[model samples]
Target: MSRYQQQSAAAAHVGGAKASTDGRRLRVGVIGLGIGRMHIEGWRQHPQVEVVAIADPDAERLAAVGDAFAITARHASAEAMLGTEALDVVSICTPNKFHRPLTLAAFAAGCHVLCEKPMALSAAEGREMLAAARQAGKRLMINFSYRFSAQSRALKAQVDAGVFGEFYFGRTVWHRRRGLPGFGGWFGTKALAGGGPLIDLGVHRLDLALWLMGYPKPTWVLGSTFDPIARELAAKSGKCFDVEDLAAALIRFDNGATLALEASWAANIGEAELMETRLLGTRAGLLQHNLDEGYRFDAHIFMEQNGAQFDLHLHPEAGEAPSAMHDFAEAILQERPHPASGEEGLVVMEILDAIYASARSGEPVRIAA
Candidate 1:
């Protein structure tokens, strides 16, 4: 079978739904109270999910979130929660440095993991986490939240339906003029974040674009990273900053397609914030971009029929798209495949690893198949 055929079969394996053998709600435990609050809210949406416990190093923040969510079983650390609760699912919402260790701990406890983005500090760690999940026979999913948007879902449907056939070129980017998160925190620390905007903000856009393009294998990447602005800002503010503020890459895929990716936490640009992804295919070209410098987004398709130029804009209905946690809950309860599986997350990690390597070496980095 061809690669696309294999991908289709794998997707089918995960997409087919089955009824639960017994009607029992899945018990969940969340790690970290920052983004973990959102995870709790999403999991609560599903009737079959019960958030039983929570873990956070910050006792005050943990108590506040746990009380706000009405979850009584709160622990000071993930190890404590994993040791105490009989949770069937665990969500890791901590820093990039903690994802692999926390995910491994959850899997060792025989729980499925819903890990936050950038999978791990590197592809090597991501592979270890994936192997552990497989050994434990549990689902491992990454929170690529951008892909869960209504506009993105609609575009994915169209792409799968052959609306844009054989994507050959693409561009995905996210930039901010001066919007670094937690400027003095771990986000600015290379040891914690692995990298700057590329791993943090760019991962979402890159995943959205690559998923739309069917995630073709990347062959090589030529990339560059810069931190002049962030370093200067850190010096002036007397804050610690060691990661790049801007990064760009040219990636070549195995299917003869090419993608250009750019990300920045600080840049001298007209827009305060900008995010976009465009895929040029043989049949049609597609564009998805944020509107009003906010989370809201819209899509458009460019095509020609009978020698006439045609432009069609998508009108995605307004509704809250199912959260990644909600989808994970349904997948577990219905015995279906997890969305944004570990394998896909590993693929993203591999590309990211290459981008960083290329940036450091000042040459193209080749990915090993």
Candidate 2:
């Protein structure tokens, strides 16, 4: 079978069937009160779910979020929460370094996990987490929020409908003029966050492009990362920044398709923030980009019909889109495949690993089969 065919089969294996939720109110625990708040929000909105426990190293944060969510079981550490709370699912929303351990802990406690992205610091850690999930027979999902957008799903619908027949080349980018987040907090620390915007922001756009392209196997990657403006800003602000402020990569897939990816937390750009992905395919091309540097976006499909070139813009009706939290619960309930499964998460991690490695070595990194 072809590479895309193999990918389809793999997706089918994950999406086709699953175990069960057993009809009980699925109890949930969330770690990292930062983005973990989103996890709590999604679960609380779900009918058959309960946000029972919350964990964070910061006591104040734990208490504030716990009180905000009406969750009484608050602990200063994930281990404490896991040991005491009876949870059916856990959202590992901690720093990149903590993902592997927290996920393993959740799996050990017989809890399915919905982990925040970049999956783990490295593909090796991702492999371990994926293995633990499989051994425990529990669902594992990565919280790739960019793909959860309604526009993303709408594009996926068109791709599935063969509008983008044989997706070949693409460009995915997210650039910010002066929006370096967290200053020199965990986000700017390489040891804690893995890499800068590449792992933090680029991963989202890269994953979105790959997911839209049916996740073609990446054969090799060439990448470059920069710390130009961030280092200067850090010096001026008295905050030590060690990670890259900008990163870009050229990724080639096994199917001979290629994608160029760029991400930056700071740049001398026209837009304050620019997020976009343009795909060139056999049948049609696509452009999905944020409007006015805001979170909202508009997508257009380009193709020729009856000898006339035209564009088809998509506008998903005003409504809530499916979320990582909702899908995690449903995956546990055997309703659908884990929308962003551990396998897919690992592939994304591998791609990220290759990109960073390439940047450091100043050479293209070939992905191990």
Candidate 3:
């Protein structure tokens, strides 16, 4: 079989066949009261999901959210909630360090999981979570919401159709100016949030690029990370900071494609915030960028016939707002596979691990086969 055929088979394997159901609703429990509030709201909107319980270390936060959502089943900890609440699924929105443990615990409780992004601190942790889900005969999903964007899906369709034939190089960037998150909060702490922009923000773009490229195996990576902005900002705000403010990496795939990734939180750049990806191919090129207030995407296909150069612009239809929680609910209810599975999240984490390793060692790091 050809490479495209192999990719199609693999995609089918990861995304299992859709199973019909009797339209019964699934009960969901959400952990971590911070971003867990968003998950609760999203799940409530789904017709096939019911918010049964909520858990948080902060009783006040949990009570506030539970009251707002009119939910009486609330617990002070995820362990306590899981033991009592009969839930079909759990949303793990805790800190980075706790993702693996929380997800595994949820799986052990016989609940499918919808985990927040970055999956875990490392690929190994992601693997363990995946294993737990498999052993428990449940589903594991990662909430990489960017891939659910309309433009992203449209771009993937065009690429798979060979509209941008033989794509060679791509650039994915997420830059922000003076937007250090949470100042000196847990977001800036290395122990709580892993690395900086690369893992937090760049992970989205990195996953988008790799997914568009059909999740090819990465060969090697060379990268660099800086903490200048975080140090200066922390000094001014009088808070502890121990993560990089800026990071960049060059990743080469086994298919001979190269990706240039750039991410920053305090870079002196033109845009206040930028999230964009540009793909260059043998036949055409594509660009998707987020501008002021909204987003812009352009596709260009070039051809030379009879010594005349021609370029065609293809415009895509507008997309709807995507909710990872809602998608997870529908997937569980319909017995369909989710777009962002545990294996895909592991690939993103593996690349992240390699990027950090390369930045620290000042040498090219090879991805294990």
lDDT of 1 by residue, 1-369 (tens): 321121100221332223384777889999987778888888988888899999999989998998898899999999999998998889999989999999999988878889999899999999999788767777789988888888888889889899888999999999989877666899889899898999999999999988899889999999999988888878888888889999999999999999999999999998877999999999899999988776678988999888998998877664668888888888788676777888888888999999999999999999998
Alpha-carbon lDDT, every model: 0.87, 0.84, 0.81
Q: Of models 2 and 3, which has the larger lDDT?
A: 2
Per-residue CA lDDT of candidate 2, range 242-343, in tens? 899999999999999999999999999899889999999999999988877777778889998889999898854635676668767765675556677778
Cα deviation at 163, candidate 3, in Å, is: 1.5
Off by over 4 Å in 2: 1-22, 316-318
True-vs-predicted CA distance for residue 184, candidate 3, Å: 3.5
Residues 187-287, candidate 3, lDDT per residue (tens digit)?
78888888888988899889888888788889899999998877876888888788899999999999899999999988988787788888788877777
**Model 1 weakest 10-residue run by lDDT:** 3-12
Clashes of each: 0, 0, 0
Query: What TM-score fits each model?
Result: 0.94, 0.93, 0.88
Model 2 TM = 0.93
- Give the top-scoring candidate (lDDT): 1
Better of 1 and 2 by lDDT: 1
